[model samples]
Target: MSYLKFDKTVMINLEESLTREVLRTNRKGAYHCTTVVDCNTRKYHGLLVMPVPAIDDDNHVLLSSMDETVIQHGAEFNLGLHKYQGNNFSPKGHKYIREYSSETVPRTVYRVGGVIFSKEKVFSLYENRIMIKYTLEDAHSATTLRFRPFLAFRSVKSLTQANGNVNQSFEEVTNGIKTCMYPGYPELYMQFNKKVKFVYEPNWYFGIEYPKEQERGYPYQEDLYVPGYFEVPIKKGESIIFSAGDSAVTTTRLKSLYEQEVDARTPRTSFFNCLKNSAQQFYFRPKEDDAYLLAGYPWFKVRARDLFVALPGCTLSIDDPVRFEKIMSTAVPALRAFMSQNSLDPVIRELEHPDVPLWAIWAIQQYAKAVGVEKARELYADFVHEILEYISGQKHPDMKLMDNGLLFANGRDKAITWMNSTINGKPVVSRSGYIVEFNSLWYNALCFYTELVGGAPVEKYDKIIKALDKSFPETFINGYNYLFDSVSGSTVDWSVRPNMIFAVALTYSPLTRMQKRSVLDIVTKELLTPKGLRSLSPKSGGYKPYYVGPQYERDLAYHQGTAWPWLLGAYLEAYLRVFGKGGVPFAERMLISMEEEMSLHCIGTIPELFDGNPPFTGRGAISFAMNVAAILRVVDLLKMYNAE
Candidate 1:
């Protein structure tokens, strides 16, 4: 039995299967995303979506989907599914699906009469290519296969119609055809391993509806162009490989390339292995020396905060310290460039976020713990010293090191923290001034940097450390025992948020053991859910638990009462910090509860967040890097505790 297998019952039911999506990505920022039944429910869902830097920054969907038809004895079975207008599905290929499994690569088995065929999809690990292998398991007589390619050469954020501007002509390649729908975009080469016949019948598929988009109050219908079809014959036990990519490839090596890619995949056999596999998917390497961790799948770009926050768990937790060093080596220079020259790297965005530098230091602290502090200091001592000086010296435009030894950020207009949902150019949750997490991270970074490079640097910031130790507890701790979310001069937001968990979770915290216990207990009581920790306590006013509805409504509720799985890393760390061996069982149970999520919304991967209320439904980005990384970190932590 496969770890992520759906039987015929679930496969045939549209309601159960359509909600479950599968995502595959390459290191070069190309992705293949669709539902389990191969139906695209969102505009982001596609067969080949990749970044077109020549056109723009956003990812463009070059190949929307491929419709496959199985023919036996001149009887054709159209094995392709598409949701049309009026809630209708065309071709209705999902009915032929006998089973869907994603243990290694995503494979779907189909049965038509006596014929049993399977389709396995593999995205090339290092290139912008997708390969599909069709195997005929059992057949009664001679069989033929036809593939129709759907083309949508537009940004994933926008849709296209039947435009006369599109160039319909295609050029012949090695046992294939290459077409470029528009200028400034890379030509997509679609090749088959074996000889096939290409019929050039250019037509537009109109009124294809994306229900996921309609539900989100966006334009849901669009037109996709079909560039004819490819026909080939197959024997009972024969397998044919089809490849689609931006560049042309040798037809003879397609099968060998597909096999090599499959051989390198890590099987999602268990909960931890599943997460580890998902973690590796976030890694994006556009250039030879440059590397980054994408924030999430389908939509998000490479964000600085997300990259740092997810780097350690995504790499270190998977027992790949070399990858961790590779990514950090690339990011540290970018961070320095931004700090000194105010130059943001084109690939990694949002470096100016007030808390990004702090999070970067935290990620390095994790690396320090993994490979002893001495080794980390030898490598990152200067970089760490530079970041600390930049923050404490008040070089950061958005963040200020105040007299009370806390970093104060003004989030009235622009969102400065990770709860960065904005509406009409203003932050939905204006967490300005002395934020609990910012100060906590600030104190932690200062302590870690000083500890990393002792002697002079330690003496230089000794008074500031003492000031934070005294002012942090007095300023944030309220009468309710839990720390305030933010303190703005005389005004205070007393919402019980998970932000305070960092105070106890950080390697070096300003809070006393008793204070840590109080903060952790409050978080566990009000914000903790089976999914993770809620952004805000439900008892607080303006708390909206469900992250649904239109864009505006969703943004309003995004951080109000939404439960974030990423926060579990901090909450669990704080739990172990306060309770030690006694908290291991509870922590284990919490981690076990997350195993159910591996089979949920996106198989073998965690979603960005969940609804804060019961039946904590997964929401937001289907496969989030932060959430996956956090879970992997917890798994690593548990292993260490068990060994002890």
Candidate 2:
């Protein structure tokens, strides 16, 4: 049996199948995302969702979905699912599903009467294309397959109505038809490996609902246009390949292209392998020379903080240091550009976030740990000095190095940290003033850079380092043996947040051994969950444990008490730091429970956050790069400890 196989019982149940989603990306900014039953619960779900740089930065759903029909003896059984108005599902093709597995490519097997059929899907690794291969495994007699294409041709964030503006005209290509819904959008080319019949009957399917959007209090209904259907004959043991892409391809090469893509996939045979495969999916290279790591699936773009935080674990933890260097080569220049000119790259955003440069240094620290300090210094020495000088010389707009040797930023008007959930243009949790993690990362970066350069650089920052050692504990560590979340002049926020975990987690932490133990104990007691650490402690006032309701309510709970899996990377690192080899068993148990997450929510990948309460349901973005990278880092840490 496949590691990620679901039987007929699970496949037929909408509750079990619809909540579990599968995602396939083409390394470029295109993807195919849908529920396990092939139903699109969200507007972002589509068969071919790709970025149109000319239209907008957002991904557009060119080919919304395709319905397949099995025709035998003049009777047709449509093997496709779509949710319409009034909580109804049309076609109801999920009932015919016998098994669904994704060990390599996503394959769905169906048994309609005496005929057995299967469909396998794979996204092209280097191009904006999605390929589906259909196999008629067994048939009592001859069978005919019919495919009807539904085109949305709208941005993922907006819904489209049945309008008079649609082009509605299509041109015939080799065994296919190419159509463009609107101007400034690339034409969609849908082709087959062999000859087929095309029927151009254009119509609009109205009131197609996306329940996920409805739940989130957004516009949930749209109209999809279907231009035509294709029909082809099939024998008992014959297979055909279908390709949908932005550009036209040679019809004869479709079969070979699909096979080559499938053959190159990494099998998700184990928990570690599953994470490794998911980590590689975040690689987004718009141009040949520029590469970036996307924050998460469905909606997230390439943000500066997420790229640096997720870089080491996503690449180095997967034992691919070459990728680590490759991504950094492009990213470091962007970082420099942002620092010097206050300019942001069009693709890589959020470079102005106060802690991004600090996170970049921390990422380089991870590289130094993996492949000696000498190599890291050889590559990142100038960049490291530039960042340090930028902050210390007061070149940053928001971040300021204080006389106390801690970095301070004002978040009263806007958010500067990663807990950047806001409502009505103001920060929800404005953790301003001297934040714990920022200082922790600052101290760590200073020490690492000083050591990387040795003698002179050590003396250069010695006074500031000494001041931080005394002032860090004096400002943050309270009488309760736990660090304060944030400290201002008159008021101090003592919320038990996961931010304090960085005080004990970083390589060159300023916290003493006893202080590290105390902080870890408080974190494990107050914020730690099976999924990860809660953003805020429940014991504090205004603690919202569950992340639900509409946009406003969800944003209120986004950082109040919602659990984030990315925090686990720091928690485990602190645990091992405080307990050494004796902590291995407990750390391993935490990781083992995380393995059960592979089969939950988004199969073989981790979500962005979860409910802080019991039965912690996964929420937010389906496949988060930071969550996957953090888990992979835990796996790497465990392997090193076990081998030692």
Residue ranges of candidate 1 with Cα displaced over 4 Å:
454-457
RMSD of 2: 1.1
**C-alpha lDDT of all candidate models, in order:** 0.92, 0.92
Steric overlap count per candidate:
0, 0
Clash pairs (backbone) in predicted model 1? none
TM-score of 1: 0.98
Tell me, by lDDT, which candidate is best: 2
Residue-level lDDT tens digits of model 2 in 1-644? 78999999999999899999999987787999999999999999999999999978999999989999999999999999999988999999999999999999999999999999999999999998999999999999879999999999999999999999999999999989999999999989999999999998999999999999998899999899999899999999899999999999999999889989988988998999899989999999998888889999989999999999999989999888889999999899998998899888888888999899999999998998899889999999899999999999998898889988999988779988999999999999988889999999999988988878853557657778898999999999999999988988978997889999999989888889999999999999999999999999999999998988899999999999999999988899899988988999999989876899888888999999999999999999999999999989988998989899
Please list the Cα RMSD from the true structure of every candidate, rounded to 1 decimal place.
Answer: 1.3, 1.1
Instruction: Report how far residue 328 has shifted in candidate 1, in Å.
Output: 1.5
